[model samples]
Target: MLVIGTTEAAYMLGINCQRVRQLLAERRVKGAYKDGREWKIPLYKKMVDIIPGTRGPKGRWRHRLQARPTYIHVNKHIIDSNRNRRENQPVIKVDRAKHSKYCHEVEITGPCRVVYRPHQPLCSGAVLWIEVEQSTRVITKLYG
Candidate 1:
């Protein structure tokens, strides 16, 4: 049986010399052994037998809950109001009991616009409003 040096084996296998030495050291290459400081590779039809494995450590979030917001709550309320002819009338009432279930109880200190659906009837004592005390900047990771 003929044998070849590390450099010749690396050239034939299309890999680097250090990698071939590593394969030899790990005993991954079949019929390959080390003699003194040099590695002797047996020249055969199929000599190299390096097994493939994961490159690095396993991920930590595979079976665990990832990072998420501390609080995530969404509430929606329907208003019931009467259709009366009035030139000027306050559409909103300060009745917090109707929407108490959906309220998160937060204070606002900045300018914000109130939004409501026109088709939906406003409740007799239903007040719905969302105020943002401060804007929050969120950075998200996008994966294709």
Candidate 2:
């Protein structure tokens, strides 16, 4: 019988090293025995079993939200300044059909108008709006 340490046994069984020691102490592993300080496990023996629970797949433990493109409206002055900036930030695309719902939601009025734009590094189920003013530019709260 090929013998291996607790760490190797844990790796073979897809479990923690401490769990392998625990299993040894509990006498769960058929051919596992303690030699001095180290626990030796037989390679061919049935050492461990996966416990049933609510965990999903290996990589997809949590669900991710879907993202969609958004549009925003800005003043001519602000738009001009943005164009002149060095960063070359993403320009707000004008999509009347897509942004109609969000346009009414922001309630565009006065000298300032509301526009919608999809956030950079797109987030799930939400979008950002850039509210440009004469002296300052502000990013509005995320809306889902």
* Number of the predicted model whose lDDT against the real structure is largest: 2
C-alpha lDDT (0 to 100) for residue 74 of candidate 1: 28
**How does candidate 2 fare on TM-score?**
0.32
Worst 10 residues of 2 by lDDT: 59-68
Predicted candidate 2 versus true structure: per-residue lDDT over 18-121, tens digit per residue: 86676577676766778999877765433333322345554211111112223354334445765677433333333321232211123323244444556542
Residues 16-39, candidate 1: write the lDDT tens digits: 678777767777666777789878
lDDT of 1 at 93: 26
Cα RMSD (Å) per model?
24.9, 20.2
Please report, in order, the local distance difference test score of every candidate based on alpha carbons. Answer: 0.43, 0.44
**Candidate 2: lDDT over CA atoms?**
0.44
Off by over 4 Å in 2: 45-144
For each predicted model, how many residue pairs clash, with residues at least 3 apart or on different chains?
6, 4
RMSD of 2: 20.2
